[model samples]
Target: MPAMSRSTEAIVRIDSAAKTVFAYLDDHRHLGAHMSASSWMMLGSKMDYEFDAGEARLVGSKFGFHGKILGIAMAAEQVVAIRTSPRLKVWETIGAPNLWVIGRYRMGFEIVPETRWSRLRVFIEYDLPKAAPARWLGLIFANAYARWCTGRMAKDAARYFETAGGQAVPSIG
Candidate 1:
Protein backbone atom coordinates (compact mmCIF):
# COMPACT_ATOMS: atom_id res chain seq x y z
CA MET A 1 0.00 0.00 0.00
CA PRO A 2 1.11 3.52 -0.78
CA ALA A 3 1.14 6.50 1.57
CA MET A 4 -1.93 8.75 1.60
CA SER A 5 -1.62 12.52 1.39
CA ARG A 6 -4.01 15.15 2.75
CA SER A 7 -3.82 18.95 2.67
CA THR A 8 -5.79 21.97 3.88
CA GLU A 9 -5.34 25.73 3.64
CA ALA A 10 -6.59 28.90 5.34
CA ILE A 11 -6.13 32.57 4.58
CA VAL A 12 -6.55 35.61 6.80
CA ARG A 13 -6.13 39.29 6.14
CA ILE A 14 -4.13 40.92 8.89
CA ASP A 15 -3.98 44.65 9.53
CA SER A 16 -0.22 44.74 9.61
CA ALA A 17 2.76 45.08 7.35
CA ALA A 18 3.97 42.02 5.47
CA LYS A 19 7.38 42.26 7.10
CA THR A 20 5.84 42.51 10.53
CA VAL A 21 3.67 39.49 9.90
CA PHE A 22 6.61 37.58 8.54
CA ALA A 23 8.70 38.51 11.56
CA TYR A 24 5.99 37.37 13.90
CA LEU A 25 5.59 34.11 12.02
CA ASP A 26 9.31 33.49 11.95
CA ASP A 27 9.69 33.41 15.71
CA HIS A 28 9.18 29.92 17.10
CA ARG A 29 8.66 31.10 20.68
CA HIS A 30 5.66 33.19 19.72
CA LEU A 31 3.86 30.42 17.87
CA GLY A 32 1.49 29.46 20.65
CA ALA A 33 0.42 33.04 21.29
CA HIS A 34 -0.88 33.32 17.72
CA MET A 35 -2.39 29.86 17.57
CA SER A 36 -5.87 28.90 18.70
CA ALA A 37 -6.19 27.10 22.00
CA SER A 38 -7.08 23.86 20.35
CA SER A 39 -4.32 24.22 17.83
CA TRP A 40 -1.85 25.01 20.59
CA MET A 41 -3.09 22.05 22.55
CA MET A 42 -2.61 19.81 19.57
CA LEU A 43 0.83 21.23 18.94
CA GLY A 44 1.70 20.78 22.61
CA SER A 45 3.89 23.13 24.64
CA LYS A 46 5.83 26.07 23.29
CA MET A 47 8.53 25.08 20.83
CA ASP A 48 12.21 25.40 21.64
CA TYR A 49 14.76 25.61 18.89
CA GLU A 50 17.19 22.72 18.80
CA PHE A 51 19.58 24.55 16.51
CA ASP A 52 21.25 27.85 17.29
CA ALA A 53 20.90 29.25 13.80
CA GLY A 54 18.95 32.47 13.37
CA GLU A 55 15.64 32.84 11.54
CA ALA A 56 17.38 33.64 8.25
CA ARG A 57 18.80 30.13 8.24
CA LEU A 58 15.53 28.46 9.14
CA VAL A 59 16.04 25.58 6.76
CA GLY A 60 17.84 23.52 9.40
CA SER A 61 16.22 24.76 12.61
CA LYS A 62 14.45 21.95 14.41
CA PHE A 63 11.76 22.52 17.04
CA GLY A 64 10.25 20.09 19.45
CA PHE A 65 6.55 19.40 18.83
CA HIS A 66 5.91 18.37 22.46
CA GLY A 67 2.40 17.03 21.91
CA LYS A 68 1.04 14.57 24.41
CA ILE A 69 -0.28 11.79 22.23
CA LEU A 70 2.02 12.58 19.32
CA GLY A 71 5.62 13.40 19.94
CA ILE A 72 6.04 14.93 16.50
CA ALA A 73 8.70 17.57 15.77
CA MET A 74 9.17 20.12 12.99
CA ALA A 75 11.89 21.55 10.77
CA ALA A 76 11.78 24.94 9.12
CA GLU A 77 12.59 25.64 5.48
CA GLN A 78 11.44 27.63 2.46
CA VAL A 79 8.56 26.68 0.24
CA VAL A 80 9.08 25.44 -3.29
CA ALA A 81 9.15 28.26 -5.83
CA ILE A 82 5.53 29.23 -5.90
CA ARG A 83 5.12 32.93 -5.12
CA THR A 84 7.57 35.77 -4.88
CA SER A 85 6.67 36.69 -1.32
CA PRO A 86 8.33 35.30 1.79
CA ARG A 87 7.15 31.79 2.58
CA LEU A 88 7.97 29.61 5.58
CA LYS A 89 7.62 25.87 5.45
CA VAL A 90 7.54 23.70 8.58
CA TRP A 91 7.50 19.95 8.20
CA GLU A 92 7.29 17.14 10.72
CA THR A 93 10.24 14.87 11.44
CA ILE A 94 10.21 11.44 13.07
CA GLY A 95 13.53 11.70 14.83
CA ALA A 96 12.19 11.77 18.35
CA PRO A 97 12.65 8.54 20.25
CA ASN A 98 9.25 8.52 21.93
CA LEU A 99 7.20 10.10 19.16
CA TRP A 100 4.22 8.37 17.69
CA VAL A 101 4.52 6.83 14.22
CA ILE A 102 2.40 9.38 12.39
CA GLY A 103 3.01 10.00 8.73
CA ARG A 104 4.68 12.92 7.07
CA TYR A 105 3.27 16.34 7.93
CA ARG A 106 4.14 19.68 6.38
CA MET A 107 2.78 23.16 6.94
CA GLY A 108 3.55 26.27 4.91
CA PHE A 109 2.83 29.92 5.57
CA GLU A 110 2.97 32.40 2.72
CA ILE A 111 2.96 36.08 3.62
CA VAL A 112 1.74 38.32 0.84
CA PRO A 113 2.17 42.06 0.96
CA GLU A 114 -0.80 44.34 0.52
CA THR A 115 -1.46 48.08 0.57
CA ARG A 116 -2.14 48.50 4.30
CA TRP A 117 -2.65 44.96 5.53
CA SER A 118 -1.06 41.61 4.78
CA ARG A 119 -2.54 38.30 3.76
CA LEU A 120 -1.38 35.22 5.60
CA ARG A 121 -2.12 31.98 3.82
CA VAL A 122 -1.45 28.75 5.65
CA PHE A 123 -1.29 25.29 4.07
CA ILE A 124 -1.08 21.93 5.81
CA GLU A 125 -0.24 18.61 4.19
CA TYR A 126 -0.33 15.23 5.88
CA ASP A 127 0.76 11.88 4.55
CA LEU A 128 -1.11 9.27 6.51
CA PRO A 129 0.20 5.88 7.41
CA LYS A 130 -0.44 2.98 5.03
CA ALA A 131 -1.50 0.58 7.72
CA ALA A 132 -5.05 -0.44 8.60
CA PRO A 133 -6.56 1.17 11.70
CA ALA A 134 -4.33 4.26 11.63
CA ARG A 135 -5.09 4.91 7.99
CA TRP A 136 -8.84 4.72 8.44
CA LEU A 137 -8.76 6.85 11.56
CA GLY A 138 -6.40 9.43 10.10
CA LEU A 139 -8.47 9.70 6.97
CA ILE A 140 -11.53 10.30 9.06
CA PHE A 141 -10.13 12.77 11.63
CA ALA A 142 -6.64 14.02 10.81
CA ASN A 143 -7.78 15.87 7.71
CA ALA A 144 -10.49 17.70 9.60
CA TYR A 145 -8.18 18.45 12.51
CA ALA A 146 -5.50 19.80 10.23
CA ARG A 147 -7.97 22.03 8.44
CA TRP A 148 -9.45 23.27 11.67
CA CYS A 149 -6.03 23.98 13.13
CA THR A 150 -4.94 25.86 10.02
CA GLY A 151 -8.00 28.07 10.00
CA ARG A 152 -7.84 28.63 13.71
CA MET A 153 -4.19 29.55 13.57
CA ALA A 154 -4.87 32.12 10.87
CA LYS A 155 -7.72 33.63 12.80
CA ASP A 156 -5.77 33.68 16.02
CA ALA A 157 -2.84 35.29 14.29
CA ALA A 158 -5.07 38.04 12.97
CA ARG A 159 -6.53 38.58 16.40
CA TYR A 160 -3.14 38.58 18.00
CA PHE A 161 -1.83 41.22 15.65
CA GLU A 162 -4.96 43.30 16.01
CA THR A 163 -4.84 43.18 19.77
CA ALA A 164 -1.11 43.53 20.18
CA GLY A 165 -0.85 46.52 17.88
CA GLY A 166 0.70 44.45 15.12
CA GLN A 167 3.36 42.99 17.34
CA ALA A 168 4.01 39.43 18.44
CA VAL A 169 3.78 38.73 22.14
CA PRO A 170 6.25 36.41 23.74
CA SER A 171 5.11 32.82 24.22
CA ILE A 172 3.76 31.87 27.63
CA GLY A 173 4.64 28.46 29.07
Candidate 2:
Protein backbone atom coordinates (compact mmCIF):
# COMPACT_ATOMS: atom_id res chain seq x y z
CA MET A 1 0.00 0.00 0.00
CA PRO A 2 1.06 3.56 -0.69
CA ALA A 3 1.95 5.66 2.29
CA MET A 4 -0.72 8.08 3.49
CA SER A 5 -0.05 11.39 5.22
CA ARG A 6 -1.40 11.99 8.70
CA SER A 7 -0.70 14.58 11.40
CA THR A 8 -0.90 15.07 15.13
CA GLU A 9 -0.26 18.21 17.18
CA ALA A 10 0.03 19.18 20.81
CA ILE A 11 -0.20 22.75 22.11
CA VAL A 12 0.76 23.87 25.55
CA ARG A 13 1.76 27.08 27.24
CA ILE A 14 5.14 27.16 28.89
CA ASP A 15 5.93 29.81 31.45
CA SER A 16 9.14 30.83 29.77
CA ALA A 17 10.41 32.95 26.96
CA ALA A 18 10.12 31.73 23.40
CA LYS A 19 13.86 31.80 22.95
CA THR A 20 14.43 29.80 26.10
CA VAL A 21 12.05 27.07 25.08
CA PHE A 22 13.37 27.09 21.55
CA ALA A 23 16.93 26.61 22.76
CA TYR A 24 15.85 23.78 24.98
CA LEU A 25 13.94 21.92 22.30
CA ASP A 26 16.57 22.58 19.66
CA ASP A 27 18.59 19.85 21.33
CA HIS A 28 17.17 16.51 20.20
CA ARG A 29 18.47 14.80 23.34
CA HIS A 30 16.40 17.15 25.44
CA LEU A 31 13.17 16.98 23.45
CA GLY A 32 13.35 13.25 22.83
CA ALA A 33 13.88 12.20 26.42
CA HIS A 34 10.80 10.02 26.43
CA MET A 35 12.10 7.73 23.72
CA SER A 36 15.49 7.28 25.43
CA ALA A 37 14.03 5.70 28.53
CA SER A 38 12.09 2.54 29.17
CA SER A 39 8.41 3.35 29.07
CA TRP A 40 5.13 1.60 28.42
CA MET A 41 4.78 3.58 25.22
CA MET A 42 7.97 2.06 23.93
CA LEU A 43 7.02 -1.52 24.84
CA GLY A 44 10.09 -1.93 27.07
CA SER A 45 12.43 -0.70 24.37
CA LYS A 46 14.79 2.26 24.46
CA MET A 47 16.35 3.92 21.46
CA ASP A 48 19.73 5.60 21.42
CA TYR A 49 20.45 8.75 19.49
CA GLU A 50 23.00 9.18 16.74
CA PHE A 51 23.83 12.73 15.69
CA ASP A 52 25.52 14.04 12.56
CA ALA A 53 25.86 17.30 10.63
CA GLY A 54 26.89 19.72 13.35
CA GLU A 55 25.13 17.71 15.98
CA ALA A 56 21.90 17.90 13.98
CA ARG A 57 21.40 21.62 14.53
CA LEU A 58 21.52 22.87 10.96
CA VAL A 59 19.47 22.09 7.90
CA GLY A 60 20.40 18.90 6.03
CA SER A 61 21.65 17.49 9.33
CA LYS A 62 20.92 13.84 9.93
CA PHE A 63 20.12 12.07 13.17
CA GLY A 64 18.54 8.77 14.10
CA PHE A 65 17.30 6.45 16.77
CA HIS A 66 18.23 2.79 16.96
CA GLY A 67 16.95 0.19 19.35
CA LYS A 68 15.29 -3.16 19.67
CA ILE A 69 12.02 -4.58 20.90
CA LEU A 70 11.63 -8.27 21.65
CA GLY A 71 14.90 -8.74 19.76
CA ILE A 72 13.47 -6.99 16.70
CA ALA A 73 15.62 -4.07 15.60
CA MET A 74 14.05 -0.70 14.86
CA ALA A 75 15.54 2.45 13.42
CA ALA A 76 14.49 5.77 12.00
CA GLU A 77 16.69 8.35 10.30
CA GLN A 78 15.59 11.95 9.97
CA VAL A 79 16.99 15.07 8.35
CA VAL A 80 16.45 18.66 9.27
CA ALA A 81 14.31 20.33 6.62
CA ILE A 82 13.28 23.78 7.80
CA ARG A 83 14.93 25.48 10.72
CA THR A 84 14.27 29.15 11.34
CA SER A 85 15.17 29.09 14.98
CA PRO A 86 13.47 30.68 18.01
CA ARG A 87 10.15 30.13 16.24
CA LEU A 88 9.94 27.13 13.92
CA LYS A 89 11.97 24.07 13.00
CA VAL A 90 10.91 21.04 11.00
CA TRP A 91 12.58 17.74 10.18
CA GLU A 92 11.44 14.80 8.14
CA THR A 93 12.35 11.14 8.04
CA ILE A 94 14.52 9.90 5.20
CA GLY A 95 14.03 6.60 3.43
CA ALA A 96 11.63 3.97 4.73
CA PRO A 97 11.87 3.94 8.52
CA ASN A 98 11.89 0.50 10.11
CA LEU A 99 9.61 0.77 13.07
CA TRP A 100 6.46 -0.62 14.59
CA VAL A 101 3.75 1.72 13.42
CA ILE A 102 3.89 4.99 11.50
CA GLY A 103 6.56 5.24 8.83
CA ARG A 104 8.09 8.34 7.29
CA TYR A 105 7.31 11.57 9.11
CA ARG A 106 7.98 15.26 9.43
CA MET A 107 8.11 16.47 13.00
CA GLY A 108 8.79 19.89 14.51
CA PHE A 109 7.79 22.52 16.99
CA GLU A 110 6.76 26.19 16.93
CA ILE A 111 7.13 28.68 19.72
CA VAL A 112 5.01 31.81 20.01
CA PRO A 113 6.20 34.38 22.44
CA GLU A 114 3.73 35.88 24.85
CA THR A 115 4.01 38.61 27.44
CA ARG A 116 5.37 36.40 30.18
CA TRP A 117 5.32 32.96 28.60
CA SER A 118 5.28 31.10 25.34
CA ARG A 119 2.84 28.87 23.53
CA LEU A 120 4.51 25.75 22.20
CA ARG A 121 3.16 23.52 19.49
CA VAL A 122 4.79 20.20 18.71
CA PHE A 123 3.69 18.23 15.67
CA ILE A 124 4.26 15.08 13.69
CA GLU A 125 3.00 14.40 10.17
CA TYR A 126 3.34 10.70 9.43
CA ASP A 127 2.61 8.00 6.90
CA LEU A 128 1.38 4.47 7.31
CA PRO A 129 4.06 1.79 7.28
CA LYS A 130 4.49 -0.16 4.07
CA ALA A 131 5.73 -3.44 5.56
CA ALA A 132 3.75 -6.30 6.94
CA PRO A 133 2.38 -6.32 10.49
CA ALA A 134 3.62 -2.78 11.10
CA ARG A 135 1.56 -1.61 8.14
CA TRP A 136 -1.50 -3.14 9.68
CA LEU A 137 -0.50 -1.92 13.10
CA GLY A 138 -0.08 1.54 11.66
CA LEU A 139 -3.69 1.49 10.64
CA ILE A 140 -4.69 0.82 14.21
CA PHE A 141 -2.05 2.76 16.17
CA ALA A 142 -0.37 5.41 14.05
CA ASN A 143 -2.53 8.26 15.22
CA ALA A 144 -2.27 7.17 18.80
CA TYR A 145 1.50 6.99 18.58
CA ALA A 146 1.72 10.33 16.90
CA ARG A 147 -0.39 11.85 19.63
CA TRP A 148 1.85 10.36 22.26
CA CYS A 149 4.98 11.56 20.52
CA THR A 150 3.87 15.15 20.17
CA GLY A 151 2.22 15.31 23.56
CA ARG A 152 5.36 14.03 25.21
CA MET A 153 7.42 16.78 23.64
CA ALA A 154 5.02 19.49 24.77
CA LYS A 155 4.60 18.10 28.26
CA ASP A 156 8.33 17.69 28.70
CA ALA A 157 8.92 21.30 27.78
CA ALA A 158 6.32 22.48 30.23
CA ARG A 159 7.85 20.37 32.95
CA TYR A 160 11.30 21.70 32.20
CA PHE A 161 10.22 25.29 32.56
CA GLU A 162 8.12 24.62 35.63
CA THR A 163 10.96 23.05 37.54
CA ALA A 164 14.29 24.22 38.92
CA GLY A 165 16.87 25.62 36.50
CA GLY A 166 13.89 27.08 34.59
CA GLN A 167 11.74 30.11 34.92
CA ALA A 168 8.91 30.34 37.40
CA VAL A 169 5.38 30.01 36.15
CA PRO A 170 3.38 33.20 36.24
CA SER A 171 0.47 31.70 34.31
CA ILE A 172 -0.02 29.64 31.16
CA GLY A 173 -1.38 32.16 28.71
TM-score per prediction, in order, is: 0.67, 0.92
Residue pairs in collision within model 1: none
lDDT tens digits by residue: candidate 1, 21-55: 87676664444343313344355533333424443
Q: Residue-pair clashes per candidate, as listed?
A: 0, 0
Backbone clash total, candidate 2: 0
Q: What's model 1's lDDT at 84?
A: 32
Residue-wise lDDT of candidate 2 within 54-166, one digit each (tens)?
66789999999999988999999999888898899988888889999988888899999999889999988888888889999999988898999999999988988888456
Model 2 misplacement above 4 A: 1-4, 165-173
Model 2 CA lDDT for position 139? 91
Instruction: Report how far residue 49 has shifted in candidate 1, in Å.
Output: 8.0
lDDT of each: 0.58, 0.87
Residue 37 displacement (Å), model 1: 5.9
Tell how far residue 95 is off in model 2, in angstroms. Answer: 1.0
